[model samples]
Target: MKKSQLAVQLYTLRDYLKTAGAVDRAFARIREIGYEAVQISGVAAPLAAVKKAADDNGLVICATHAATPDLLGNRAKVADELAMLGCKHTAFSCVSDFQIIDRGAVLEFAGEMEKAAQELNQHGLTFSYHNHNMEFGKIDGEYILDLIYANAPHMLAEIDTYWVQYGGCDPAEWIEKYAGRQILFHLKDFRPLFFTATTAPVGTGNLKWQEIIPAAEKAGAQWFIVEQDSCAKNPFDSLKDSYDYLTKNFVR
Candidate 1:
């Protein structure tokens, strides 16, 4: 991917974006950190202010993690907000109270996502689904993530690397599997914690980025988004570290 296609998922800086003034400053810092684009999520500021912040910093609103409820029940409203931000893509973050063991629940959610994708298509916007480790569970022996992609053909894949690995699957293989249907890739790294793993800046953790980046490129990805759900240091520093690694090696 080109450096221009690299972006920061703003959810990583959620705490810093709680106000319009904060959004403006945070976005400026993001631009200074060398990110050309951002995925809007978890920002408490008004949409107008968010747009202004991006514009003021010369950052593109590449995509967003739109709320699941809004994607399922009010696609038009989501579309309007995306249009206002001049972003053409948005992803359903996750489901609520989802029971992975229930096959019916999985299929039901897939159908709903499909309907939402259709509605989003009408608005000339792409709809995608963001996954977490829970999606790897088996329902009647089929992976829930596989089922979601099969049942909801219209929804594009927004694969999160750390979550895929956490789910006990190979991240590169999954990214290649989606091929043409996937366009957004969340690059999150994880380091071993007490009993599990915790978020770390890309390339600093144990993830195999050398393999993942090539796989994502071959999958026709349009955005390579850097994200760390939680950081051990200042979030902006974490963002910069990830950006430095990506631009130096992966981005062209």
Candidate 2:
């Protein structure tokens, strides 16, 4: 993967991006940290302001966590917003009302995703699903994640490495399993924090980056985004640490 492919998931620094000016400041810091791209999520600023900040920082809007309401309720609006931001890819993290209780539920959500994806495609945008640990559960003897992808052919996979490990699966194996169907990959390390597991800066935890990076690259992942949902110190510090590690090692 090239250094240009490495990005910061803005959700990691959600607390610092509450307004237009904050986004500008945070993005400047992000660019200074050596990230050339970012996945937009959890920011409160308007799309126009976001675009301006990104442009000023020389940061590429690689992907976004599309608002579920707009994605399911109004695809045209989501597409237009992404177009304004100059982003071609968006991923649905989750919906508040959507629940994956069984096989039927999974299929139902997949159908919705399929419809939304088709609509987005018409507007020159690609849609993907971002997974959490809950998706690792089984439904009708199949992993919910596998079932979702098996059914929603139009929806790509945006696998989160830390969550995959949190769900008790091998991150590299899953990336390899979904080869050629992924354009965005989340790179966060998982480790035991006292009594429970938590996310860490890339290469700072126990995750096998050497294997994960190669698998992700081979799987057609174009963006390797670092996201630490929770951090021990300033989120920007965590972002810099991850950027330093990836650029020095993986980004070639």
Candidate 3:
């Protein structure tokens, strides 16, 4: 939280950034709200267009979320793509067809991701796993997330604090447990008593950022990417509010 910069995960702006032009506007607005960086995910614009827009607004492309298919089908292109954005951190968001709750299934899937991680590493990119609550299901006395990470220790962990809390675990604990393996941390606050587990900006929900922030810093997290999966107000407003909360409470 005492870092020099904070970033917004573009997934929070997914619905708003539907087209090339819209993506451009989103970057400009993010800059206006004092966000110096962004994690690209669920963005549908052309890679060149996205890079140009980020450059135009002086917004750093900090990290990204990629689908499994893209990783399998386009490894080199993925490398080239991140290079285009001047981003070295990328992650596989989730598995599409694999059984996330089963240890055997997850280990096998982690094997595939391990291969991708190694290949991407050769290209100077770090490939990581981003978890959701579903990964918290226990298999043989161990969480699926832990099992998969244990089997594939080389892949980085992009821990989502909100999902970890949703899954009944302390985000700070996992951040501590994973220590040197965490390269990116997703900051999403969970508002209590909301149907479908509504998400709020960081510090607006029940999460313990007082503890979460120090834990992340102590564990040496590189970036805290703020993401709200659902916003009660305009998405940009939600982003600005999150930005204000982080800058006011954490750091500029």
Candidate 4:
């Protein structure tokens, strides 16, 4: 797929959307910036209102990242909302805080995800998990993410490239290893700082975009959503720079 065929992860714009009327305005700005699609993190407004904003801006809501509590407690409601908004994929944004401390908690989480995936699958929505740096930590000499993938082979992964680097692994390697299991990618770049990785606009960071993009495409990534967790300036400027860079260098 062309690089212009990109989706913006609305989480990157969270700061701008903190107030009541900001989400609608943010969606409009996203469209004006030339994004064709969006992956919603959370919209405090009603589902209908969110859908209207997307429609007004000519942006497709292709995917969403919901908290595990929302998914488990209100699977039907969540699925219905996503379906109404024209989203085909729903992902658990992060593991519970407790799960982060208790490594064993992931097995139960995986079980829950398996059940949730089964439930959402019936509604024509594929379920997935979005990873952070914790999943890359070594447990018993293997990455915890590997264990999750092993336990829930059918579950999709929204691989965050920056987190992969932060976890001290290669995003392209994971892309090649998982292949078809990764349905989407969070395409953020990382800049090395001291002992850690920091978010940078795509192409400006150390990530091998040339290698990673092609690998993700080969692995069947349907959406490459741009995300910068903490922007150096306004979120829109960061997004515009990243979008321009990717389009100029990667998009065909």
Candidate 5:
């Protein structure tokens, strides 16, 4: 399948979502830019309003990213809200604060995630975990991400390419290795520095998008959400440039 056929994660337009009437307008602009699907984050509008905006703008809410609190404690309510907005997947973008401490804490957090995944499965919705750099830390000679996946093999992951690279791992290799376990990815590019990295538009970074995109597709990734945490210019312009660059050059 074509990369353009994939969805855009609306968190990429977080600035717009914060503005008045911007959520509605952003969906319209997303459609205008040839995106038919979106993964919602920080959706401030009512479920009905969000659904209406998506429908009016010809966009499909394929998945949603929520806080761990929203997913673990208020899952049923959150699931209902997502269902009302036509979302099929609910992804936890970050873990609870307590889970940030050490390896043991991470394992404990993984157990909680497993339970949450089972709960979400019962609700007829798929659950996913979105990764950040910290998840790549080594624990007992294995990455924390590996431990989480092992603990809950059924739970899906939305891997962030930039974070994968930031953690000193190859995102494409993981895509191939974890095929069928990762259903989505945040396809942000990163520029490698001496000890840190900087994010840039897709092809402008050292992410090896040429290899990663195809590997993700082969791994059954249904959505590739282009995300840049910080942009030199406005977020919308950054997204537009990234979208154009990907469609015109990177995607085949």
Candidate 6:
């Protein structure tokens, strides 16, 4: 089995990670909390400075959630930025527009991604799309999400288990369906409120991590990123709880 490391998405700490100095302190705290890897996003520092912080603290940037405009606009340039951070795994994170409802818009996006994936592959980088519940609506007989992946074979799937559940699908089933294409898996827990689902730490909520973790491992996932968009307590403490849970239980 390929080793899967537990990584925390920096976006989970976005409120605390803005400037270069803030990023440095956050990385230091992450290391102190025993997280050895991170998935970068929303950091304002230059790529060199970000790389330096990770290197200085012995943190590995396993993947990143870069801007969608940057990825679809100039993939080669994005590839250069990723290379600078010694990162080969990346995803657009989410779609900001409702154009995914239009077939033509999806096709256009897929075409751009095909070329971008090719460019990224040439640079030894992998590209993927991270989903939210909005992607659940199906087009034709297939999901817009599945259609996008089918259109670009080189583009990988970075499945978020919680979103899959929120979208009314079994996350493990989707994980198995995209077996070989997943490069990074987002590990988040979900709990039902009155009419909606809310984010929780990895194991403290309703997610079946045992099933999800093994499924992702079977699918060749390299990093399992713990991400909780909102937390009830201090966000860092919530992250620490998740990090400790995964380390003690799943990660090898």
For candidate 2, the lDDT comes to: 0.91
Tens-place lDDT per residue, model 2, 1-252, is: 998999999999999889999999999999998889999999988878989999999999999998888887988889888889999999998633246887778888889999999899888889999999989989778998998888889999999999999989999999999999999999999878786899999989999999999999989999999999999889999999998999889777
Clashing pairs in 5: none
lDDT, candidates in the order shown: 0.91, 0.91, 0.85, 0.82, 0.78, 0.84
Candidate 2, run of 10 with poorest lDDT: 94-103
The worst-scoring run of ten residues by lDDT in candidate 1 lies at: 94-103
Candidate 4 Cα deviation (angstroms), residue 108: 1.5
What tens-digit string does per-residue lDDT give for candidate 6 at 105-173?
788777877887888888888988889887777887778888788777889999998899899888999
Q: After superposition, how far is residue 110 of candidate 3 from its true place, in Å?
A: 1.0
- Shift of residue 188 alpha carbon in model 2, Å: 0.5
Please write out the lDDT profile of model 1 over residues 1-252, one tens digit for every residue.
898998999999999999999999999999998889999999999989999999999999999888777876888899999999999999988755554458888888899999999999999999899999999888788889999889999999999999998989999999988989887889999788887998899999998999999999999999999999999999999999999998889877
Note the residue pairs that clash in candidate 1.
Answer: none
- Once fitted onto the true fold, the runs of candidate 4 whose alpha carbons sit more than 4 angstroms away are 100-103
What 10-residue stretch in candidate 4 is worst by lDDT? 95-104
- Least lDDT summed over 10 consecutive residues: which range in candidate 6? 1-10
Q: List the residue pairs that clash in candidate 4.
A: none
Tell me how candidate 6 scores on lDDT. 0.84
Q: Candidate 3 at residue 192, lDDT?
A: 76
Ranking by TM-score: 1, 2, 3, 6, 4, 5
lDDT of 5 at 124: 84
Question: Residue 30's C-alpha lDDT in candidate 2?
Answer: 92
Q: Residues 89-146, candidate 3, lDDT per residue (tens digit)?
A: 9998865545664767888887888888989999989988999888888888888888
